[model samples]
Target chain A: MPIYGVALLAGCTLVGLFVGDLIGAAMGLEANVGGVGIAMLLLLALTNLPGRDVGPASPSGAGVQFWSLMYIPIIVAMAAKQNVAAAVSGGAMAITAGTLAVLAGFALVPLLSHLARGGGQRGERRDD
Target chain B: MIDVARFADANGLLVAFVFVGLVMLVSAVLARQVGRGRVHASAIAIALGLVLAWAAGVDTGGKNGVADYPLLAGVGVLGGAMFRDFAIVATAFGARVTDLRAAGLAGALSILIGVVLSFAAGAAVAIGFGVTDPAEIATIGAGAATYIVGPVTGASLGVSSSIISLSIAAGLVKAVLVMVATPLIARRIGLDNPASAMVYGGLMGTTSGVTGGLAATDPKLVPYGAMTSTFYTGLGCLMAPSVLYLVVKALV
Candidate 1:
């Protein structure tokens, strides 16, 4: 059971975007797919800490089960004003956003590996 | 015999909860097998649940909104499981993979391709719809986001950010930050970088409020980080409108 898996997802995704936007603006760039792609990779790395030994293969569903149940309320709210058709219509972009985000993520895994190599050449500095 | 539409309209959330609970219960019952049977059953159960919900006239395609509650609950649970799996994969990789230098180059190219795809898709949609005002569309998106996440977005991103642009921009930047910040944070928190990056990236992607990976990666910081990040993102989502507005003003 990861202590902070769901607990941190909401805030980081939203704020990460804001920060990303600010950075993008600074660079005179708005978000294209690539920018969003990097952000997805960033998200994958950010969640690693609180997520230790808390997967199905590990044989414990207590932690995630609780959070998953808690999401009922949020989902209730999500469906409170719409239905499947509505979600697909109103949320088509969001769904698109989610799907695209994952694709961006897959592409990022390898790219980040390359970037890490460059960062290493600077020095044998292990912050960890 | 079952008039699902009527039931949902009257007790949508409760109805949804009951349905999801039943599905979980069924999955649990199926687990008394050869062990491996449970894993396959779990996935099958999830798919069945989605199918049942859709067929039972869940009304996710209607205007009442209350009908879709069941779907959300189910999806949420599944999403958590999938995310948990991704975390484990990252952890394993970090323990094994040492050469992060190469990962960064791959990161840039991948993100570039993703961004182009998003633009093409968005442009095609905009052109098809005959919608000329990008700002107006962004504003509408901000409002919709406000409805879902709430006023929390205001405090986090500001009151004038654009929803379309903000979401696209944030989603990607967080992706890049995964590589830049994960290792440093992993070290600070005493975890491996790859593990840190994968888990942290997922957290920030879903939550969107944590700063460095310190809160997410550290064992001791998990509880505090979880609480803080939860409150902030929920609050930020609520305030999304104000934040989006500010972003738009500042950027434009």
Candidate 2:
């Protein structure tokens, strides 16, 4: 990744994190607020600014894309490591949350599919 | 003299990386041998991670598992907020504003509806399990949205460590289920075309699961499905700590 793009991202992230900390402090939170989320929103807005015409295929754009693709899996791995550690040792509630979440997701599939089918048909009707 | 043991201790992250890489390699081999690609490498990796975490916890009696060891201290920094937050912020690149227009209203609505329903279902489960804390409930609910959402919600809400872990476990389970089930039920669920895959992804919301499942079902559908699933994480991240948490708080 180009240093500039990475640096730019880092700068944005720090500012966002600082602001998030401020927000968290204001809310009486003992931790950072939505720093990462705010940084993402700011990055997205800045990068995709209307009429800017920064080609998505450009090197800088590609650099951003490259890091972005790596984001979820990497973070998930790191976070999953911590979460796994916690769940394995903690009370039954942790396990319960995980189990129920999966069950809930499975249960929602049919209902969601049904809704999707109806919506798809409606769209088809509109197009026709 | 550069002592080898001291170097090893200093380069803890390197050790952690090696450890994780070995797990991935083993998981991949296991998936190939046992699951025959039916089970995703990621699912196996997560299972291995949990096992390792449990073992490390037992051995060290510490909160951070292997990171408690002098040689494995890098795991803590490697998995800390600096890296975690950076990875999260970088996800913004995946969201192309223009591509979203293709999904349009139906797709958009499905994403929102999917998020809400998942959150509600997860929250309901938390309540049933006697978890009355709004933060805990919301974190679990967000995990139902996606594993990524779970930690973000938990961290934002400042819930306990265990609750956050549960959220991740929930997301992982969902991912595994989505990976294994999507191909089997693809035709039955009308997951045949790009549009339908997009809808399915929106409704499911786990990027790894949606993408892996679509890859198994039909390689061509992976991109379409992944697109919406990416949006699902962003949406979940936004809603879980804010809207969904608020709703759960109000109810409880």
The TM-scores, chain A only, for the candidates as listed are 0.32, 0.65
lDDT of each: 0.35, 0.72
True contacts kept of each: 0.06, 0.37
Q: Which CAPRI quality tier does the interface of model 1 achieve? A: incorrect
TM-score for every candidate vs. truth? 0.36, 0.86
lDDT (Cα, tens digit) per residue for candidate 2, span B58-151: 6777766556666666666766667777767777667777878877765787688778878887888789878888889998888878877888
Report the number of backbone clashes for model 2.
0
Candidate 1: how close is chain B to the reference, as a TM-score? 0.34
Worst 10 residues of 1 chain A by lDDT: A31-40
RMSD of each: 13.6, 3.8
Which residue pairs in candidate 2 collide? none
